[model samples]
Target: MIEIIPVDTPSLGDRSYLGTDGEVAFVVDPQRDIDRMLRLAERRGVEIRHVFETHVHNDYVTGGPALAAATGADYHVNAADPVAFDRCPIEDGDVVEIGPRTRLRAVATPGHTFTHLSYVLESPDRPPAVFTGGSLLHGTTGRPDLLGREHTGTLARAQYASANRLARELPPETDVLPTHGFGSFCSATQSEVTESTIGLERRVNPALTRGEDEYVRSLLAGLDAYPAYYAHMPTLNRAGADAPDLSAPRRANAAELRRRLRAGEWVVDLRSRTAFAAGHLAGVLNFGLDGNFAVYLGWLIPWGTPLTLLGETPGDIAEAQRELARIGIDRPAAAATGGPADWAGDDKPASMPTATFAELATVRRHRPVVVLDVRRDAEWRESHVPGAVHIPLHELPSRLHEVPDGEVWTHCASGYRASIAASLLAAAGREGDVVAVHDDYDPHAMIARFAATGGSGLARHPL
Candidate 1:
């Protein structure tokens, strides 16, 4: 029997697959932390024989080279990919035999990248499974704009043709396994569907249902700014990343934490948003472990800045380190594990106020405050609180001066980002008065509360 398992890196919204026929296995799109893949293979009692890359990734460093080297597996990458490392260069129509029953056939599916490939896993008496790394995703296709805007139009058309080719060529029952689209910005649009098949995709996917021009137009129209860290991924991926060194970072005391903060280095707190808002070391920012920690932290922080992590436990620090490493953040300068008091030393930990939308509405009735929305441009353009100043979280570092001085009330789609913004405001000496709206941004409720109080708190923006 052939067994396929998935290794999910939920923090980065990507998945690597292990396909095995009991004794031997192959991995697809492994992340930088290859230890997990090793442990998984060990547990499965399978020896890895091959590692495959659908494309040189643009979201995170691939663990293919490291995993292959560790297991003495043949590393398979597209012949067209300009990777520096040695690989078993594969091309369209290349078939790789995995075991007696399992074989992978490469089908060129260019769109996500110029030379993307989808591997079809065929085994006897079972439905074929297509490992579509970044090309064909669940209910959507990979974004064509990652390479560059200059290549977007042509790549988009290629993407449409590719998706159709897969649909027309593959049997409807083929199980579709993709590397991205579970909150990864690699997707053309966010996909809510957890699992899909070629039959399901033909019925629901925009690329399959809509005409090429309409699909391209809608995909282009729906595009938003991806994470800034994404710009660094292709470089690291091209030069084949090694296995991440997940060893504990040098321990930092309270004094060292204070020194780093004074030096304008990033001292991140990896606790929950609630814990972070309640009390954290002054000058420390909140990119809580409970949220999209890597994506936002990588997006906001000046790249290559010395980073120090403060977590409640060693495991939290380790987890953060692994997530950072996937995005090519190799090592942290230091780490501290304990409560706020432990990290604060003699200095009293600073706290920020967190309120709900109702509380914010009530406060606005009595006083004037700067309502700052830190969601992305797309989110802001969809609908937002009326009269709120918009600054996307990624752009906040450079655009901090644009925010008018006042008692700022910060919010995002969810409270996670708002907490980060609140911490930034606190670090900027706007503490005590800056309230984080730790609640879901429900526009209807916001409109009702403010409408009742003689104002419109929410305004809808036209597309």
Candidate 2:
């Protein structure tokens, strides 16, 4: 019996699956952390014999090459792709044996990427299981726009054809597993569920149900901007990421951290957003250890930026490092761990300034305050403060100047991003003028919040 164990990254809601018939196991679409898979192999008393990648991943760094090297297993990728690093190049119709009753057949499913492959596992006396990397998903298909604005239409068409081909070619009872559908920004829309059979998907998947031209148009329209780090992933995955070092980062003294900050290293504060807003170092930015840590860090921080970290404990620092590794940020210069007391002997505590929604309204009325709405474009278009300045949180550091010289109160759907923006706004030294509204806000109800305050509060009216 083939035992399939799913290794899920809850932070990103992405999954990698492990399949074994006891002695030999194969991992599909692994994250950068290979130890989890290794531990599973040890637990199962099986040897990891093979590692397969569906495509060059754009969301997180892949574990395939590193896993292959560690276990002396074959790491497979598409033969047609121009990967700089070595891999067992596979093509359509090529079969890979995993065990006596199990083997994987590579099928060309070129929509997510030009050379994407789906591995179909054949086991005796049972229906086949297809690992549709990014082709056909539960409710939607993989977004084709990751290749860029120019290739969107062509790839969308390709995705439609490929998705339909999968439905037609595979048996209805075939088990369907996909890598890109679950909240990874790779899918055209959020997948309703992570697991679905080919039979079930055919009945529900929009890509499978819609006409080819209609599917293409709908997919293109639904495509949203993915992380900027996505643009760098293909190259990095092709070249292969460096082996991860999960060891606690070397310790840096407060003085050294100060020096690094002066040297312009990306000084990151891995603390709770609330804790950070209450007290954090000047010029340091907060990305709470909770929330979408890896992807946002990958999205906002530039590629290969030298980094320094400040956190509360060894575990906190380690977790931060691991999250950073998820997207190929393998190294940080050093970490300064412990509370504010460790960093400041007796200096006054510092905090990222914050304001209440009511205080924000009061501030707005008294002066011309810039209500910076740091939500996504869609969220902003849906509804935001009537005269709020819109700049998505990820773009705030570089676009800080657009905020202008004024009392600025930042906000997003929830206060997570608003806190991060508040820190950045202050770190940019807007004359200590920025503050965060630490409240859970529904974008649609923002106008009502203003209207409830009465007297045309910042262009107040129901949205």
Candidate 3:
């Protein structure tokens, strides 16, 4: 029996699957989560024989080489696309045998990337299973504009043809296992479901429904912005390099950290918002080593920016380094040597501005205070506190004129965006008390308290 193990990298939140049959295993789209894949291989008593990338992924750095290094697995890519890795380039119809009975055939499915390919698993008796990386998803198709707008139309048309090829050629009963599920930026129509059948997707996926031209047009429309860091990912994957050893992550004491900071090094605090707010070294930018940590870091920190990490845990520090490497941001000066609390010094830590339910009730009972909900438009419409000005964090820098020059209480679904908004207001020389509100606090009570008592106890003044 063939066993498939899902390796979910919390850093990228990208799911990579490992397929095993006793003595041999094959890994698909191995992101930076190598330990889990190794453990899975060990549990099955198998050696990883091959590492496959469905396409040139932009969401996170590929871990194909890392896995290959640890397992002696041969890396595989599309024969058409010339990659610089030590790979066994396979064309459509090329087969990789895992055992005396089981094999995987490469199926050329270009369009997600110029050289994208899917794999079809065959084992004599049962129907085939297609492992589509980004070319074909359960409910949606991979976005066509990843390369650029110049080739978007060409790529979309190619992707459409490829999808049709699979729909027509692959058996209706083939089980389709897609790399990216719903909520992935890779596919425009990622489904909530992780797996589906070729026949089932053929009936439901919009990318497979219309004529070639119309389908291409539909795919191009409403395409969201790819993360800025994605532009550098393909090259990194092409030239597979060893990931920096995380167990021996570079560490520096407070004095060294201060020296580096002065010498143009950036301090990246990877602690959670709550931990960061409680007490953190001054001037360190908090990107909380959470979801899309690297994506935002690429935007906030300049390319090739020297970094010093202040993570909540050692694992968190390692994850920060891995995320940075995925996007080719590999230079880290060091990790903070001491714990976060130790670095805070003797100054009574300033509590992050917050309002209790009772305080909010009194504020809402009074007048003159405005709550600025700096969440996305969709979030605001879903359900938001009344009397809140909706301004998305991305738009906040440009739309500062819209916010009234009065005491403004800023909030997002949580306080993260609000803190960012508050910082922006301070930088803009705005003459208003800008306070970030934590999501855990009751908005109604805070609003009412402001109405009753005129404002929260915080003073209203310019930065």
Candidate 4:
């Protein structure tokens, strides 16, 4: 019998797979924290004999080398990659016996990266499962333009061919396990669920349904600007991140947090948006522990910027650190825990003014404050407050000049992102002028309310 377990980091919606055939196992695309894998190996009474990556990752730091060293497993990646690390270089058609009944054969599938691969597992005792790291996802494939815009067309073509190869060669009944596309920016298109079968994909996958030229067009056109932190991952993963030191980024007190903030270190408040807006330290960004915490942490903060995380508990700090480290934002100078009471002295605790959508409607019509829709471009396109400045929260730093230099009210689909943007504004000296719409108020409904009530109150939607 074969057991394939998933190591999911829900913060980023990323999954790594470990397949075992009783005596030994091989892990694919694991995160920086290899403890989970270690424990799994120990519990199953199996040694990890090999680790494989489909491509040089452009998202999270890989624990391939660390896990390999810890388990004495041979680590492998594409030989086409120029990563300056000792790795067992693998190419297409290379076969490995993971155990008695389970065997892995590598298929060179480039497109996501110039050196992407999909590993097809053959099990004599069970049905097959293919681990398509970034090449063949549930609904679509990894975005081709992650490396650069120039290679998009070339990569898209390569992806089209690679995806076809899997569809043509793999059995229809084979399980399709992809490392990305389930809420990860790595995918060209997002998929609701992470699991699918080759038969299901054969009928629904765009690469199969759409013509080659059309697939390339849609894939390239559908691509959105990826996080800047992405630019660092390939190189870091190639070189290999040092084994994660969970003990680093030692705890700090209120004073040290203050010092870090003063020194311009990114002080991320890993609490709820509501809690953060209620009261947080002055000049801290609320990249909340709840939302896509790691993605935003990497996006808004510059690469290699010093950071100090603030959390409600030690558990929060540890979780946040683990997620952040996955994306190469390791080694926070220090972390602090507790509420505003622990961090605040005689001075008043820092807080942002928040408004409900109804209140924001009134504010917008009466005083004409800049109603900023801090949602993504797609969200704004679907619906938005008429006349609201369209600056996605990630673009706020660079597009600050476009924001009106007066009182501004911000709202996202929910208040989580709005709170973060409001805090960023506050940190950039707009504390008095930025208002966070911290309620779970629907923006379009508010716009409809504005149409019906003349911004007086929430009312029935009007044409």
Candidate 5:
């Protein structure tokens, strides 16, 4: 039996695959943390003989080179990719036999990037499975604008044609295994459907269902801002990355932490959002371990800025390190474990109060306050708190001066970004004026609630 396993990096919304015939195996799109793949291969008792990369990834550094080196396997990358490493360059139509019963075929799916390829696992009696890395995702395709606005239109059309090509060439029962679409920004749209096949995708996928012109237009229109850190990924990936340095960083004392903060370095607090809101060392940004910690942290932190992690436990710092390393942040400058008191020493920790949407509605009746919407532009366009000030979380630090001085209630789709914003505002010496909305934001419901509270709701959309 040909068994396939996915190594899911949920924080980055990507997956790497390990396919085996119970003896030898091949990996696809491995992350920088290759230890996971090594351990998985060891556990399966399969010698990793090959490593494959579908494209020059823009999300995270690839582990293909490292894994291949460690296992003496042939690292496979698209022949067209200008990677600064030695590897088995494979192009479309090339097929490699994997044992007597299995074969791997490379198919050019140039939508995610000009050189992207999808791999097909074929066996004698079983339906083929295609690893459509960032090409054909569940119910959608990879977003085409990652390359640049100039290439978006052409790539969107290519993406539509690519999806159609997969549907036409692959068997209906061919399993559609995609690398993006699980909340990854690379996806044109996120999909909750976990499992799908080419046949199923043809019925529901926009690329297959809609005309090329319409699909291209809609996909381009829906594209939003991606991570600022993504600009660095392709370069690092092309250069190649080794296994991450998972060794514990130099332990920082309270004095060292203060020194780093004074030097304008990032001292991130990896605690729960509630704990961070209750009390955290002043100037320490709250990334919080409870949510999509790595995604937002990697998104907001200035690339190459010295990063020091403050966690309640050593394990938290380790987890954050692993997540950050996947995005090519190899190591932390230092790490400190314990409560805010341990990191604060003699300094008084800053505190920010958190509120729910219902509480926000009640408070607005008696007093005037600024409702800062920290969600992305697309989210704000969808439906936001009516009349809320729009400044995306990623833009808040640079645009802090534009915020009207007042008691600011910052919110996002969920409380995560709001908490981070509140911490940033407090770190910027606006502690007295910021409140984190620690609640899920539903714009229409908020409109109704505001109406019931005798506030203006007619201008806001109501459901």
Candidate 6:
């Protein structure tokens, strides 16, 4: 039986491993979580025999070389790309045998990248499965705009032709496993569910719905904004940038932390809510170093923001730094210079009380603290805390003057954006106390609690 293990991408959930016949494994579109893949292999008693990249990714850092080095596996890329590394260059019709009954056949499927290929898994008795990296997705094909305008027209046309070819050529019953899901930026439409079948996609995927010209035009429309750091990724991947050394986190003490902070270094705390609430350094912004940590941090910390990391454990610190590096936020000024206790100083910002739903209700009953909902318009419309100011996190810096000077309770779907907004407010020397609301709790109860106190009146409902 072939065991498939999905490695969570920093934000894009498309990285996975395909283990063949219980003893040999092949990984596809590996995220930076090399250890997770290793652990999966250990659990299954398999050795990773080869690492295959369908294409060079721009959405997140690739782990092909890192995993290969860890397991001494052969790294494979398309022969056409001419990657600068010792790798097995696979081309169409080349079959890599993994066991007595299992093999992977390379199918050249370009357009996403000039060298993109999908691996067709062949077993003796079952329908084949195609690991269609970015080439084919559930509702769409991979975007051809990665090559930019210089070749977008030509490449997009080529991509459409490739998709049409795959639609017609691959077996109707073949399973399709893509490298990106519905929400991923890699494809114009990433599905919430990650995998699909070739036959299923051919019937329902809009990108494959029409003729070449119409399909190409559909892809070009409504393409989401690429991450700011995407331009740097191609170079980084090609150069095989050094993997983050998780064993060694930058060590610092209270003095160094203070000096770095004063010297314009930004402190990013990557800890769980419970851990962060228990204790943390003053003035640090919390962007928990967990899943999607890189994507969120990339948004919160501007490019070139000198960074210092704070985490609950040693591992957390290293993981946090690695996530930052994945999105090209590589400069880690230091990490946990001193434990929270030792770093307490007058410079530490006073810890503002966070409101529970009940407490917020009491405050709102008597007086209402300005509630700034930092979620986007779509999110706010779906559901929001009543009597809240709506300013998406991205616009907070420019719209600072809109928020009143008094107490301001900030919230997003979760506390991540709220924390970022609060930090921005603090940095601006705003007089208001910034509080983050836990999304799991009821917002109405919190608002009622605040109202009961007659603490402050809600005013100036801005459109």
The residue ranges of model 6 lying beyond 4 angstroms of the native Cα positions read: 149-159, 210-221, 272-280, 302-304, 328-331, 337-342, 346-349, 353-411, 431-463
Q: Write the per-residue lDDT of candidate 5 for residues 1-463, one digit (tens) a residue.
A: 8888998988888988999989999999998899999999999999999898988999888888889999999998988899899989999999988888988999999989999999999997478999999999999999888889899888888898889999999989999999898888889888898889999999999899988888888888888888888889999999988888899999999999999999999999998889988889998899988888888898998888999999988899999999898888868999999998999999988788999999998898799899999998777777666567999999998999999998999999889999999989988888889999999877667777677544466243222
Candidate 2 versus the native: TM-score?
0.93
Reference-based TM-score of each model: 0.98, 0.93, 0.81, 0.94, 0.98, 0.78
Q: Which stretches of candidate 1 lie over 4 Å from their true place?
A: 452-457
Give Cα-based local distance difference scores for all models: 0.91, 0.81, 0.71, 0.84, 0.89, 0.70
Per-residue CA lDDT of candidate 4, range 146-177, in tens?
A: 87889889999999999889999988899998
Which residue pairs in model 4 clash with each other? Answer: none
Error of 5 at 382 (Å): 1.5
Q: Model 6 compared with the native: what TM-score?
A: 0.78
Residue 38 local lDDT, model 1 = 95
Candidate 4 lDDT for residue 15: 91
Candidate 3's displacement at residue 263, Å, is: 5.3
Cα lDDT over the full model 2: 0.81
Tens-place lDDT per residue, model 2, 133-252, is 888877788888788778878888888888888899889898888887777888788866867888898899888888888788777766666788888778889898765989877888
Q: Tell me the tens digit of each residue's lDDT in model 3 across 319-352.
A: 7777777667775777864455555455333334
- Model with the higher lDDT, candidate 2 or 4: 4
Candidate 6 per-residue C-alpha lDDT over 1-463 given as tens digits, one digit per residue, 9 for 90 to 100: 6656666653545556555577778888777657778788888888898888888787777778788888898888877765566778888889988778888889888878888898888887467788888878877878777768687777777777777777788877888888865456677655665667778878887757787878877777646555556676777677665555555556777778778767767877676544555566666666765535676667556668778787667777777766766665665767773446756555554454566555555566576588788876645654556567888877776789999868887777667667667767765675247766655534444444444344342222322
lDDT at 84, model 2:
77
Which candidate, 3 or 5, has the higher TM-score?
5
Candidate with the greatest TM-score versus the true structure? 1
Model 1: pairs clashing at backbone N, Cα or C within 3 Å: none
| Residue 191 error, candidate 4, Å | 1.3
